[model samples]
Target: MEPLGRGDPRARRPRGAHGFVRSRDGLYRPEELYDATPYSTSSDARAYQWSSEDRSPDALLTRALHDESIDQALGRWCDPRKLVGVMGGHAAERGSQEYADATRLGRTLGATHTVATGGGPGAMEAANLGASLAEADDAAVDEALGVLAEVPSFRPSVDAWVDAAWRARALCPTPSPNLGVPTWFYGHEPPNVFATSIAKYFRNAQREAILLMICDAGIVFLPGAGGTVQEIFQDACENYYATGDKVAPMVLVGRRYWTETLPAWQLLTALARGRAMEDHVHLVDTVDEAAALLNRPPVSRPSAPDAR
Candidate 1:
């Protein structure tokens, strides 16, 4: 490939990009690096790996501005009012049934709603992959999923993992409606290749809030650890406070995983009892059911418990 940026007209040369060039859709592809370093490639993960000098105070401000600009651009690409997020563990991997189920949910939701993600691997990648594949057809998704099944995890090495993903893309280069909101704070985890529209940020807090706020329709929660749990509560807290004037659905994908395994679902539902967000809190056995929850109208935000 003729140096990723040199030959491609689409490669942007930003005025104050600070080593990060926000491309037409995905993360910036650094023009300086030779060989396919993470930053040089279009991989979302590379956007988080800026050198110390590149992250100097002056550069950080510029990068922050660039991230904001990218978010502005994304607002034009899809209706923020129709976004539905899929939240889950970044370690879910490719071949597992959990990953496969997430992919199906993305395909289902992406057909009618724009799929949003935290923009990392595991379940995030599976869902974004599904949304992208859905742009073509169901058979295309099946073929790509088979290719990914051969090399399931990126933890072993991103090179082999990325290679398999590229092979799948070559087989099915469908337009993707998956919007990824990733941050440099978790750069080691690399942004998954699936989201065609990525909003990479330097601030993790802002990214998290934006991901939850923009998903107007709802969010789907998969089995996860601390971070995912934190997200659930943060989102719930916001809806409880009616901070944004609207509260969306919060659907848990695995019934057993949410109830028996974690029990966070019980806590959330209990808190939501007799409240407006109650109708929006759903526990489903399949991806289809989760998608169905989004397809319906969100419940009104009832009067929250007295904060006093």
Candidate 2:
């Protein structure tokens, strides 16, 4: 046979002169890395050895679910405003007080924002779920819940994770839109189902960068782990340089977390004191304060003729 063309069926096969040939075992493939066929009862004991190996059902299901989620997220991210990310720890449990706080934040933002998250449990789920619950209209809430109920908290089994999410949605309907920008690298924590949509990624770094870039107003950083810290610095760098189309506000929530936990508050304060970035940063303790800072009108620059 001639060399495989790019558009040819054989092109999909492994390249080079290693032509397809049957092995001694009667398998019709050179790369017989694994036995992947069924053995009949009439076959000899040796025949069973070459029989196909079955992959773990759970693993197969998880992969399929993950692929589907990634595809869904990709579709959602096409519209930037459809996403609003919330970065926080996956360790936050379902019923914890911290989870409740995160949920409250989600609700407040969800009322006006699209409400996006890292798509795992804890704070992510709390925020999405809160937004899902804040819907005043029953029918609209039920529709949203039905859609999100497909995937619940991240778990060992994709089936369970998806089922739980669907259950949660069924239990609490939502009229507003929410999203989860989860990562397959952290696949153990499935995307929260409460999110109306998802924008999952293979790389956390790329996912985070995209999340920060898309937020028109800016992100709100709650207490979190290394991931949250990384985001804080990244956001600061963007603001300091005025990297994007406009210099959006970088509002840091939780004074204690910024001041004590990470000391970012101190760093931002020092940077602001330098005059170059005096009005760029606003460190606050409450959501209301952060919202107000974001909504404040921009100061107009003096015209050159007027200045002279």
Clashing pairs in 1: 45-191, 276-302
Each prediction's number of clashing residue pairs:
2, 11
Predicted model with the maximum TM-score: 1
Q: What would the per-residue lDDT of candidate 2 be over residues 39-88, giving only the tens digit for each residue?
A: 12212112222222223454334334434444444545546563345667
- Per-residue alpha-carbon lDDT of model 1 for 42-112, expressed as tens digits? 33434444532375665666566666765676667655447889999998878888889999988888888
What are the lDDT figures for the candidates, one per model? 0.73, 0.56
Which residue runs does candidate 1 get wrong by more than 4 Å?
A: 1-47, 51-55, 243-245, 301-308
